[model samples]
Target chain A: MIDVQLIGLLNATLQAATLLFIAALGELITEKSGILNLGVEGMISVGAVSGFITAINTENLFLAVIVGVLSASAFSSIHAFVTVVLKQDQTVSGLILTILGLSLSSLIGKPYVGKKLEVKLESLIDIEEPLNIFQVLLNQNLIFYIAILLMIFTAYVLKKTMFGRRIEAIGEDLKSADSMGLKIAKTQFIATCVGGAFAGLSGVYLTLSYVPYWTDGMTSGRGWIALALVIFGGWKPYRTAFGALLFGFLEALGPRLQTYGFEMSPYIVKITPYIITILVLVFLTIIKNGNTGAPKNIGIPFFRENR
Target chain B: MNKFILSKKLYRNELATFYSFLIGFLIALAVGSLILFIQEKNPFDVFSLMLKLSIGSVNSLSNSLNKAIPLILAGLGISIINSVKLWNIGAEGQIFMGAIALNFVYINTSINNSQIYIFLLLVSGFLGGAFCILFPAVAKVLFGVNEIITTLLTNYIVFGLTIYLINGAWKDPASLNFPAAAYVSESVYLPTVIGKLSSGFLICILFTLIAYYIKDKSVFGYEMRIAGGSALTAIYAGINAKQKAFFAMLIGGGFAGLAGAIELLSQTHRVSTGISQGFGYTAIIVAAITGMRPVGIFLVGCLFGALTIGGSVIQTIGVSSYIAEIIQATTLFGALIAQFFFSYEILKKSEND
Candidate 1:
């Protein structure tokens, strides 16, 4: 019975960690390319709404997830355009996007409120075999496996590849990189868009695999946690996966503890992820002596010439 | 020839801002029209109806003015900090704490003594907001934690704390099952000064003047500009960056708190979660769009206030209130894009540069 309980708890933890992992990966890429995309929450909401609505209408989980990713990326592109191309304050632009996304999603998703759907993924290789921990962990919807693989791929690309070097060079010092024949604008723009695409995909994964249903503000605060995970991971893909897992464990443990007859205010338990973020941020602060190895040009707008 | 070059540059920059604003307006109109179009209604008719409802009558005009009151104050707070390059995202939280503090005074003590109570309430709100900066201020000053993170994090903490209190200790008993505090007495209410216009409008104007005075004429203001424009230069000139950031955030928090107080006492007449209503967040955009200048903040605030109030008027035509939000978002996007022109010239090709 104890072993069974442990398995259930670990499964819940892995399930809960998927959204944050996807989002943190997205943010990690953007930050690596020297931009702070604060619109993750907004993009998540947009994806949730889009994914939920598409899935409900067609009753096709695959199509719904695709729609979710596209919608979130499209929404995030607007953020990229405003902050990157237009040279606005990324923080303010992001806050506005959050409000816009939340309000817009709520208004549009009103029709589909309370409607539920069970996601039926296309059959895969026999993965859900009973009692094997590896199979149990890997038996999640295809997106969960994809998320882990993407993290590994991202780690390899960022650490080993030449493209990764250029991205790092640009983020470290755009002026120096420009002098070295790097296309600063094009590189940053692509990084931001790709980051946005992954962010949207995270939201799609949330709606399709984890929640498997539609609701307004469904992925509440998960985006913020994902953002914190990027910081906790110190901007490395592998470390970010670890941070996501920790967050997922905390979130899953909260409800499970209640289920096991532990008495605690759900509100207090809900604050666990935020409290952990604070602690991790403090730890990272100590590690960096306050600098935290931030991208040199990370929130600063780059102008081609001196005006 | 040099003068001509400068003039050309200025025109290009101005034109960018103008185009951004124009595009924002077009987007707003398109969104409004899209909503109507989707509803199978005539877009033109719905828009006209919105105009008629928002400013078409004295009642609606009063409503718009009331809405403008808190926005103008919050906009000023946003404007000041942006000038110093400090990201004070804690405004909403500051405002919430301010409202909570003001209510404590208004409810616990009898304001029936004199008109001084109003002044006291205003001061308390300002102080309350300033107080909310305690933890984050310490974090930034001592540890160099990005004020952005601390300030934003505090907002959720304060919001959660407020909800916890309201649901537990502060729940009104005389009322029905709703979670609310007691309605404040009339003596504490801000009096109406004009034909249905409350004194909140006058407070907004007065605060605007004070902010303008401090920003443009004060010696302290000059130091703040120096610090914001060039931290290295300011440090060389003997200005402490930590102290400057602290002072800017303190004032910013206070002004936002004052907005919360005004919102509570003058408009809502009770404390609730809806009091902030993105006003603190949107105020940042208002400040940015106006280039962080006091006069510009006032104008921008009025424009947005008109848009918000006008949006409600058009709601009778089955248009969602989110149309206002779309307008706000697009306008902010436009303004930020416009700001890029001030720093860089957009050439037809990279080779031109």
Candidate 2:
């Protein structure tokens, strides 16, 4: 029989992966539409605070989740305006968004700091067995199901749908897209907002389902990790979700290993995600695959005057 | 149908810069007012209070001066690297390395001399910061990796390293339960240039002059700008872009390291991760806000320094210190938008239509 601890570890891995998958899905869609929102870190933090505050006061997960999504989308609208409408540097604006998110969240989240909630998101269905593989995999929260559905939804839209093709077309060749009469600004703006909403949903999961607490900088660098995961996944939904699961396993492995009572530096666990990102980038470039799954116009702003 | 559109200005018009910055300031103030109104406080009173506390008294002004020392150094570092069009986001890590280096030197060296050792400590700190960015610089040149990700990741790694040092190896046993690095001796502390502030301000001024000379007069500065403008063009003109990137990163990292060392030797007096408080990121914003001009960076660095110190003054009035950060970020975003207007003008729809 598999020990209870091992099963718990497996379950934690899925939970962690689900959060990353949701956020990376948002980034994937954003990047697919030729927009880079580096403000995921900021957006996630904002979502975390807003979600936590809403959960505490209202105890309504539905409202908390909506607030979380809308607030982040609202925050990222500035980015869309700057990068898409105004034709500014997207990278700088995205980074600035992060700074704004973090500072703003901390500033506004002051009263809600150190607060806790009684209710938390529970597993959709109770497990039939105590420590079985099926129980570990199937008995998960609503967000886990959302993540799986989103992956399929994203993959289907990007492959079979005309909307996905339009986004990809714009990302690949903005001039061509513009000439084709595609609404570049409108498309990018909506895609970016959706990305922000997904990112914020990840934040709600963090505060509402995962830690179920409110604190400053609680999202930590998960947003950055998700950003990297999008790249590591080669901008594909399936691959990115897989990569997130792998990362989630790695994240869970460290803590689970600590429970084994080994003398190790916990700091190693903290640095793992960061170190993994650089390594992934290095190795990916080294392989030099024919197609390096990146949106060609990822960071470059589309200037209408240029053509 | 009539619609307004921004047209590119052929010549660099000074009026555009003024108009854009004015608009940026106005937008930032408007947003700030909304927040203040929501909080039920007079926006004017708070703004004036922040201004008064920051620049009104000698003590507060000196405090701002003291704070600006590190910011100016870090900003100058960022300015130089930015001129080469290579982002050095690792300045935060570099600053930490600098603080770590000086702390190791100060506590371990047991150097009895003052002047020589202090100078040596500052240099070592600069070297420490430089070494932090060396890897990303070389990797970018040799491997074609993105420095933005690498630099940012390295910062986290070094931050973790700092936590390890403070909580574990460097933790003072006598610190009780606090778990901090060893405290520096009083003798090695930087001398005061003014009331309650250390002489690091003077050193920053010297660096500003040096930075100005390099930017305008130095042959290397000329090369860096050309390389930044267009790398393919620079290469066609026989300029080695790799060497420029290498040296540019080196200089940028060095300045940040020096800031770290000076911050420790002058103000903080010890090593800790919180010592930087995102100065590396703030310096990047400062460099951008000032248009990457050395003198502009100096003046703007002081402005940010004042804003930081003044941020604390309003907490008692039911405000959060993060309000300072919100204002700064809003202004940064506004200024970024302003740059667009500065570069372009809305051509009035002529009646010729």
Candidate 3:
């Protein structure tokens, strides 16, 4: 019975982890191309609204995911243009994009406030009768399986592909990459847009697959937590997945604690992810490992012609 | 020659500000109109009402001034940090923490003398703001953590910690359910210099002058500028980069703290969660709009403050006061977009090309 419960817990963990995994993967691609995306929350919010509205209209869940991803990618392009091309302060630009996106989403999503939708996709797939591992992991939504496949694919691309080499080079030294005839701006832009798509995809999971309701500021701070998960994972694809799972566990921990009759402040539970992030940061600092690598020029606004 | 005179350098600069302001206002109006339309309301009436309420009379003007004072102070706080190439996103947190610190001091101790009261208030405020900065500064130096994330995260921590305190430890004995601190003693309240206008507004002007003087004349300011301009060059010039950064953050935090203190003593007259109401965050827009100039911050802050006050009074015309948030956001959008002109040029492609 305890073992079955543990499997159930793990299954629950995967559900929560899927959204964050998508977001972190998206952020990783952006950061790998040397642009730190702080507009994850905004992108997610836009995604949530876009996904919810589109799903309600079309009644096609997959189409909603596509719309959500595309919108998020479009939203993230603004960050790319300002930071990569315009060479503005990345942090300020990202912060402004966040505020703008938040307000813009609220304004645009005003009509659908308080309305809820019953999604049909939740029962569309049930793989639990198949192979045990697949049943345990892939038995959830199609998006959950897609998210895992994306992680594997991303890890493969980052490690084995020539495109990844160029991205790595750009992140390591833009000047050197430029000298070597790489298209710096183009690479960063594409990566950023793709990253944004993942963030949006995460939003689709929330709207179409998870709650299937429209609420103002529904994405909440999941985007920021996703960003932190990228750091907690020490900037590796596999570790990033694990970190997302850990965060999911913490997120689910709130409800579990309540269920287990251990009454705790919801605020304290709400703060657990942040507290864990700080703890992870402190632990990372103390270990002082030389192996974990962040992109050298991650937040630096690249000005090609200025040099 | 006529064209040259029309495009004269001084006129060109004035034209820039004029165009920017016009564009910002129009954009805000368009957005506000769109929102009103969605809600099935008339936009023109709402805007007209907004204008009337904001600038209609002396009372509204005073109300706007009252709003502008704290915004001006917050803007100054933002400008100081930005001038040194630091993004102090913790101002909201700093303001709240500062208020909490001041209130803690206020409720516990009774100071009869006015001088001691002012002294303790300023000290607590400065100390509170400074304490908030310590985390980011330490994170920057020790952990290689960017101050941006640390500062931003500190905001939630401060808010959470403060709320925890008010609920658990500092809940007023007499209040029914609302979590509120004790009423501050009258001696601790800031003196009102103008009729109905609190002395806090005066402090904003004083700080602006102080900021200008320090930025222009002081060696410390020069070091900060050098540090901001180039970290390598500052180090090459025998300036202690670490010390300068630490000092700049401290001053930035202290000024923000002082704003919180003044706000509590003058306006709210007590510490509460909504004391700052995102002033610290909005100040970023003020600072950026001003291009990190004290004069610019003062003007922009006043503009926002007036808009905020005007937003409320305009509700009689059926528009929500929250429209100010949209307008402020639009101004920031305009200001950031305007900065693009400074950085890049847009030109028509030639037919041959």
Candidate 4:
């Protein structure tokens, strides 16, 4: 019984972590390209709504996911134009993007409230009885496997590719990068769009596989948590993936513990993830002496002539 | 052939912000109208009705003012912190903490004098807000942790605590099935200046005046400006940048808390999760569009409050109130674009060069 319960908890933790990891990976890319997009929450909401609507009308989960990703990417282009092209404050612009995305989602999503997705994203392998923990872990939806593969691919691209190096160079020192003839604006715009796409994927995963339903404001505070995860992981793909799992464990532990008849306020359990994030942030900042490998010019906008 | 060059303006344009707001307001109106048109409603009719319902009558105007009370106070708080180049994104959480603190004091004490009780609750609310932000401020100052993330994370934690209290310890026995604390005694209620308008409106004005004075005419304000402008310069000028940032954060938190306390004592009279309707978040926009000026905060707060009031009123006509948020966001974007132009003028490059 104990072993079975532990396996169940681990499975739940991985599932929860998949959502956070996907979103944070997108944010990691955006931040790595010298743009701070606080519109992740907004993007996720838009993606979820659009994806749900598509799924309801067409009953095609694959097409729904594509539409979700495309719409969110389009939405993020506004932030890209306002912040990157216009050279505005990233923080404020991102916040506005969030507000706009949220409101826009609600306005369009009004008709689809309380509607459920007809088809669900299914797992890759279906075994009636799992022989071990590995099987149990592998018995997740397609998005879960995609999340892992994406993490590995991202780690490889960021560490090995010239494109990744150019992104880092721009983020670290935009003036130097521009002097080196790097297309700062184009690279940052692409990076921001990529981030939006990942955020959309996370949203699609939530609606199609995780909850398999439609609800307003269902993304909740996960986007913000993903933002924190980027910092917590020091903007590294592997480290961020690990941090996502840690947060996922905390999120899953709350309900699992209650099911096991533990005596604690559910609300207190819910708050543990946030409290732990703060503690981890403080610990990391102290050990790193304020240099947590963040891109030096992460939030600053670049203008060629100004440089 | 000539290329456009962005040249920095030599003189500060004070009227630039005014013009920017006008442009932003018009942009927001256009967006709102477009959205309404898509919904098969007449944009002009909805807008005119919104204006009429929000400010046409004395009672409607009073309701708008009442709504503006919390917005002004919270906007003042945000402006204070923002002036110091710090982001106090936890204002929403701080507001809840203030309400919790006020309720704690009200429920525990047996103070008979209404004046004393109200004063004590107000102070407690301020302290509560300050206390909530203290951790994040200290973390930012001492450990060099990013306050933005820390402050935002605390919001979730505080919200959880509020839910815990209301559902468990503070749950009122008389109000069956409702997740809220019992109402306070009538003696502790804030006095009304007019129809449905609490004395909180006066408090907002008083706080705004004090903030304006501090920001425009005080030594601390000057030092704060220097510190926010450049920490290295501030150090050279014998100003403790860290200390200033800490105090500014606390003050910002206090403003949010006071808004909460006033909101509780004057409006709700009870503690519930629905006490704050994102006033803290909306106040950020209020501060942003106003350039963090105390006077601008007041004016923008009133405008947004009116928009919110009118937006809700139009819900009767099958229009979603989310239109208000959509408008507020577009206005911020428009103002941002306008600010870009105000600071940098486009110039034609000479062919000779």
The digit string of per-residue lDDT tens for model 3 on B85-125 reads 88887888888778888887876787778878877987798
Q: Name the candidate, 2 or 4, with the larger TM-score value.
A: 4
The residue pairs in collision within model 1 are: none
* Cα lDDT tens digits for candidate 2, B1-353: 43554577678766554455556667877888899889898999998989999999989999888888778898899888877887877788889999988887876787778888889899989998888888788777777667777787788888888888888889888876766687788877889966777788989999999888777679999888888889788989898988988898888899999999998888777887667888887787777666777897898789888988888888877777787778777877888788876666776665654
Question: What is the total number of backbone clashes in candidate 4?
Answer: 0
TM-score of each: 0.90, 0.95, 0.86, 0.97
**DockQ of each model vs. true complex:** 0.44, 0.58, 0.28, 0.73
Give candidate 3 regions above 4 Å deviation.
Answer: A3-12, A56-60, A111-113, A120-139, A208-218, A254-265, A289-292, B1-42, B173-178, B185-187, B191-196, B312-322, B346-353
| lDDT to native, each model | 0.76, 0.84, 0.76, 0.88
Chain B only, TM-score of each candidate = 0.89, 0.94, 0.89, 0.97
Best by TM-score: 4
Predicted structure 2, TM vs. truth = 0.95
Highest-lDDT candidate: 4
| TM-score, model 1, chain B versus true chain B | 0.89
Q: How many collisions per candidate?
A: 0, 0, 0, 0
Listing every candidate in turn, what is its Cα RMSD in Å to the true structure after a full C-alpha superposition?
A: 3.9, 2.2, 4.9, 1.7
